[model samples]
Target: MNTLTVYKLGRVEYEDGLTLMQRFAEARKQELIGDSLLLLEHSPVLTLGRGAKRENVLASDELLASEGVDLYQTNRGGDVTYHGPGQVVGYPIFLLPKERQDVRRYVRDVERCVIDSLAEYGLHAGIIPKWPGVWLGQEGAPDTRKIAAIGIHISRWLTTHGFALNVNTHLPHFNLIVPCGIREAGVTSMKRELGHLVSVPDVEDTLARHFCSVFESERRESGVSVRTVSITVLRGHGPEARVLMVRRIPERGGFWQTITGRVEPGESPEQTAARELKEETGLDVPVRALDYRHAFALGEILPPMLVEETAFVAWCPEGHEVRLSAEHDAHEWVSPNTALERLEYRGLREGVKRAVALRGELTGG
Candidate 1:
């Protein structure tokens, strides 16, 4: 019973996160590092997997770029696919004995995470034995939707470039390319399937729990952790109001340093942030007056999703009661000072400061 190290990074575009996970997995295999998982969301990118055909990408490179899309090649086992805003992608890097290697089993476990997550929002998902990933509705249901899609790469028994769950995703983004090389297979998000908005944190929480449960049961169970931190500004009675020092969420608790989720079509980042905050922490806060303007990296660590991100600053109600959506088990409100001490990321802390500063400077601090 050793503590499994779970490292959660946030708001990384598709390719950067994917590339880091792959490299991390390789490093873990090279040196016997304990089990670890990297969870985050990606920007828009059209990724072609090992089995993908170039024809699956209908848009030319120049055209895709003009429309803010990226293309990439991945080692994962699948064909052409799209990863953009509103999707959560996970990569778990671990080591396994030769006999413990099971590709199909590992993939099914990833799909299970999506299924369990979808069920939390009252959407039941199943698998089409003929295909991988989780399917929407029952086997014979008409107008079935895809709740989640999983494509991964496993090397020397380690895994990377995991599942992508369409939560509050923009479905039109998929029209630019043929998803998973299936010309007719349509893509759907949780919000789309449910006919309303769902919380990203809620989906992420369910997915994380499912990932831990399935992955642990099949292999050397490692550690699972979760945490909460707030980024705030520190001001004294003077003109020099300083941005609060950011802390790192302990490695013992899963760390989600960057909290950027996708804006479902028609939704602004402020609206999405407010909704996501409410879903993760039960509260109603108006995003209308909140500051909106921040920089985010726009590129899939894969093929296409090299788009620019428009950021926003969300302000919660002063004393609102928090109803923990099934997504977060615990919550805390800390100043940037405490956040920097408690959160496990250094670079992301700086990003938060820059984001906060940008919001203030642009909107009149």
Candidate 2:
């Protein structure tokens, strides 16, 4: 029987958790690790997703600091949200199987998981097709309140950034931010609905069960086998610091990553990779001319349907001016020294190091 890689934790450090999750998804896709789950909690903090409006967060920096809460702009969907001691943040980095990889469907499925889990506690939940989360009670019920939030980004059909369910939330902390930017609609919690705090293990178990059911049905229907890509580091160059990396969008959040895309039907992997680079970043360099191929997986913390990814490298440096497509938001010409420090994926970093090392060897630098 196929199984998921499950990780459990209490409080993950705020600064690194989001990046780690992004890397995990990328590594899984690049390396092909099977379904994986990263179960963890966040410190008292506020996070703003891609569409989040900064003005929605009403508190001043001094005020937030006084309350021991930190604000962060994230790559996920939705508006401002608060994470505290009791919320169980489940990042399910799963490949979207061939049969069930639709982004909209994946979002609905996550809402279903949360709704099903809530049902176990005698709470009825529903989804507002116009809104992207699970809500308490049935549609049109006065009790409706968002119970969970979903947002994601996919590279090569692999996913990253996932759902956050308010298990035993600290409601007061939420007051500072406009949850999902919806001032009229309130955010609900398991504690609020159940009148008691729910255990993280219990919630985790429920989520696992729902996910297994969702994927099992998918696997039976479509035969895409999933795998988690393991992370490997290759040493090269000076300062032990110089590295090259490729990261999925939004997790590198505000930074620009080299163009990346999935293989299309009848498309060669190299062709797809080269095309995506041009489409996403607008650097029209030929794939044959640049660097070397470094392959890895963006693991299963994603849509739970996508499978397989192989990445290769080709550099377009300072001499070039890029014409980026709308798929990407920005671009930059970063040096290998800076690239090593700034780029996100472990495998991509290693690939950069290898490229730099080879360039020096060929030039006798």
Candidate 3:
């Protein structure tokens, strides 16, 4: 048995993540490294597997860019799937021992690790007869929600491109594509079902521990990681109402988007929203926090990390003129759909939709 060294690399960009796992996998095959478990997060990216269909991806490049999502192709054994912040991705570099070279058994054991780990939180998860991965609900129900996804690529008995478990993952992001090219079952997350935030670190550690037990190995952890925070401000009411959107300066990824800004240390997302609204739009109005939270991965800047962003809605007093901040060069008041057209993530879009849908009730109009 070998020590299952685990590294908690916060949020690696998809390409970098792939390269990292590949390096470890190669080392394992050459007997230069012990069995290893790489646990981390990836910024929003859709990966296509062998036989993956093009139509599986419903969002165009412009749409994905507006949402800050990326797409890639991989050799993993599945269709198209997504990964992002608030999700824990595990890549195991384990060389099959003489007595345990069965691929089917290996997949089952990997699934069992997830099943047992989820049970720690009182969740009952299991495998579908043919669908693979961990799921809830009746065995034959095609529409059951899947909380975890597994797609591995094995070479010379070594494995990579492992599992993705939705911890506090934004399930709406799955709407960007037909997950694993499956229109049958739906997608879900631990936070969505539990109705609370599950510490993502706890989920990662639990997964490492379970994989060690399942693979008959000990554990070693590397670098500690933390999460980033941000906020979004959507203005106006529903279908007919217009929401305020701002265009960032070229240096800040110049794009038309909702008023967005990062949360400073010791600041709550609500506070960040208000501050961003005032700073980006000069809107001194109090913002009503929407019941919306979504996360995505960003590695473009140094020390890539995952960010959890919350949305807020503000109603300006009539006659408020445009005041542009240095961060944004231009601003516009557009319909909800127009605002969302330049936005990605399903959760954030849905938040906008819900805010507009409840406008009548929210304002008693």
Candidate 4:
């Protein structure tokens, strides 16, 4: 069975995540990375797919801007949709196996992932005929409301821009647009349907598990053999948190990574994490071990090698200066989602998400 790597990107900007999807889709087309799923949330924003109508966006540019929502027209297959915090967005960067190249079947599989996930929450979700995505209530029923949306762009049998399921999303945000161009239908969320708050991480885990089941792939957890530490540095707590990421110098291939390094002889993973954080960014913050770990097979090796990682999260004040070491040329304090989108590796992206959740638990934020 093929192994599916899932990256939990807590929250990200629409454009940054889109660019990453394009890159991943291209890499999948080239057979570089295996089938991977990106789980994330977007800052308040509305996206217009290829079939989008401007009339669907009910709010004016000024109004949206004032509300701090960014708008973009995308190349996906559906109409206008709103994406924001509390909505779980899944982008599957997959190269369909030869026998499963049918786009409709592929979409149904994606819907199945969401449907099965909702089932775990005691919610029955199904497809509405003539419309893509998973919905609540019976098919063609007037009271049926959309609980999820799927918009995808496929190239050469590879896919990107998958689906969004409303977990704790603010329903009023959908009022700004005619969701998927369905005028009579309403939008509902897990929080509303369940009469309680549903943690995004809980939904994320359920979705990833079901996605793996539906795709006939093995779910490989990150961190298996290699001894290494991945630190997701944040500047604040809870919703106000911003992740700190550094760009490697030209000599190091110039890819972005969270604070990461191999453990030295006799050095504990926690010590290595603290040392790496200070060495990489000149930050001496306390490093706390997160519950997150990841393992991925190294690519392009004659003999396959698995790299294991233990993830950590560190808190620093907002305005703390990040002094880059020789290994890094630049640093940016980005949103947790942006950090996840910017990081090039799946392990680091998932590490950041784990760190964010840990922070929330510690701060009760």
Candidate 5:
């Protein structure tokens, strides 16, 4: 059996996640990594697949902007669909090695993973013959609803763009389009059917386990601490100082992380670090890019992205109040030790430790 590394990236911007997905597929193609699962939630956005009809999207650009949603055109096979908070979006980067190259069987296995997992949650999810995703209730019935959406891309025997299962998703967002170009059937979430909020992490964990069962891979854990292809800004100053940490919302994996964001075009890693500091936490502290730089695969095998990161420390000359962005649910100012204990990944904790070690010289303390 093959070993599968499951990467649980909490909440990533749609474009950022998409870029990494493409890279992961390439890695699999080149035999740089083994099979892996990329599980995450995208901020509100509408993705039009290669087969998507423009008419399926009903929302105007003005409305989407006002709602803080993004629009994208993608290469996957499907009609228009919404991916947002409270949804479990999974991308399985699998290579169809020789004997098991049947596309139909592969897709069915993907659906089966979801079906088996949802069953554990007390929802009997299955496929509706003509429909491509997992659905609840009998076919040709008013109560039948799509609980998961699957649209994928396979090229050079590699797979990408897996499935999106609605856990506690905002169903109204589906109203912005004729989901999968079907108008007769409606979409539903676990929350609506179970009459309570479903645990996102629990659902994610279940699905990962099922993937192992269905995909013939051994299970291994991976998550955010394996930060890759980005800049991390550790914000805080010393004298009596504390570093800042932010807790992500439950939908985005509910964990603590430092200020981090992608290095956008025309932006240096140092500039990106400083920008993320201001954008994410409303902080304007001075940023010093560390001499340390390293590259690692995003997770054990995810995006198998060989990320080159530039680390920075934002030293505050004095105390400043924190105003957080929507991505994080909570913020804290704590000692380096406390922050290290609270952080979820070794990658992040190490960054905090580095920041602490260099404080005196960086700030002229």
Candidate 6:
């Protein structure tokens, strides 16, 4: 049986998460990594998929901006949909077996993951004919409500952009667009159905476990010695926010990266982040945790190990001079786009984007 690696990134910006999905899909296509699942919540944003129609977005650019929601044009299948704080977005990078490459079956399996998860919460979710996500109430019933949405993209038999389950999502946001281009049915969430606040982490765990079951895969555990910490350094607030990235030494092939280091004995991830920040860039700023955590396999040595990472963000006062450690040769303060382009690793790039989004939330950008 194939083993699936799961990364629970607490909350990420929509576009950053999309870029990470594309990178993972490409890697899976090349057989660089095994099948993986990325579970995250997106900061309030509306995305238009490949088949999306502009007409479905009822709000003007000004309205969306004023409401603090970002709009993005994406390449996933399906129409316009809203993703925000209370939604769980799962992006599965899976290489399909030759006999199981049917797109319809893949989608059905994705829906089954959501259906089975909902069942654990005592909600009977099923599929609506011709629709791609899990729904409630009988088909053809006027009261049917959509609880999950699936939009995917495939390349060389590898899949990306899996599904979004509405847990405690703000329903009013969906009014800004015709979700999945479906006007007949309404949208609902676990919180709505259960008449209580459903924690995102609880739903994430249940969904991930069921996803493995539906795909006939086992979830892999991380090695104890593979713990690490990464930090996203930011300057300024809101639209003016800039991320700090360092270029590794020539011996390391000069790849750009954020502050990263391994945790020492008796040190928490946050403590490691702070120490790494001071050591790498001579910055002593306070660190705050972000909703991001991911693990990746490393090395070709016997019994390959997994590196589990916890991410944090720190504010660098403007004009702070960076003193590079021997580990890095150069450093730069750049916009998220430049950081994303310069960073070699998908995880680091996503970390930078998450930092930018965190700044927006903090400063109300």
Off by over 4 Å in 4: 223-365
Candidate that beats the other on lDDT, 2 or 6, i.e. the better one: 6
Using lDDT, give the best candidate's number.
6
lDDT of 6 by residue, 80-140 (tens): 9999988999998899898779988999999999999999999999988777688999877
lDDT-best of 1 and 5: 5
Candidate 2, residues 1-365, lDDT tens digits: the string is 45666655445545546755766776677765666766667767888888988999999999998887878887777777777777877777777778877888888777787788888988887888767777775556665688887776666667777788889988888788887786657787889888887898888778767877765632211222332121111123333322223344574455534445666677776677667766665555655333323222234343334233344555555435556565555554456767767766544454455566665665465
lDDT of the structure predicted as candidate 3: 0.76
Tens-place lDDT per residue, model 5, 198-262, is 89999999999999998788998765443322234444456566877788889978888887777
Summing lDDT over every window of 10 consecutive residues in candidate 1, give the lowest-scoring window: 221-230
Q: On residues 1-365, what C-alpha lDDT tens digit does candidate 1 reach at each position?
A: 32245444556655456545655665576664656666666667888889988988888888897766778888888887777667777676667556548887777767777787777777778898866678875555566557577787776677777778888888888888777766545778877777888776666666667666765532232221212222232232123333323222454244444343456667755667666656655545543322222222232222122222333344544445556554344555555555556544333454455555655675476
Model 6: per-residue Cα lDDT at residue 362: 77
Q: Which regions in candidate 6 have their CA more than 4 angstroms from the true location?
A: 222-266, 269-365
Per-model TM-score on C-alpha atoms: 0.59, 0.58, 0.62, 0.66, 0.67, 0.71
Better of 2 and 3 by TM-score: 3
TM-score of 2: 0.58
- Give the root-mean-square deviation of each candidate in angstroms: 13.6, 15.1, 7.8, 7.5, 13.0, 5.3
Q: Compose the digit string of candidate 3's lDDT tens values, residues 1-365.
A: 56888877766667767766766666677677788787888878999988689899999999988887889999998889999989999888788887888888888988999999999998898888768688987666765889999998887787888899999887788999998877888988899778899999899889888998988887886553332223344444444577677788999878776666777778887787788778777788777766655444454422223355566767776678868899888888778768789765454565665566556577664
Clashing pairs in 3: 43-297, 238-356
Which stretch of 10 consecutive residues in model 5 shows the poorest summed lDDT? Answer: 225-234
Candidate 1: lDDT of 63?
85
* Top TM-score hit: 6
Which consecutive 10 residues in model 4 have the weakest lDDT in total?
297-306
lDDT of 5 at 162: 92
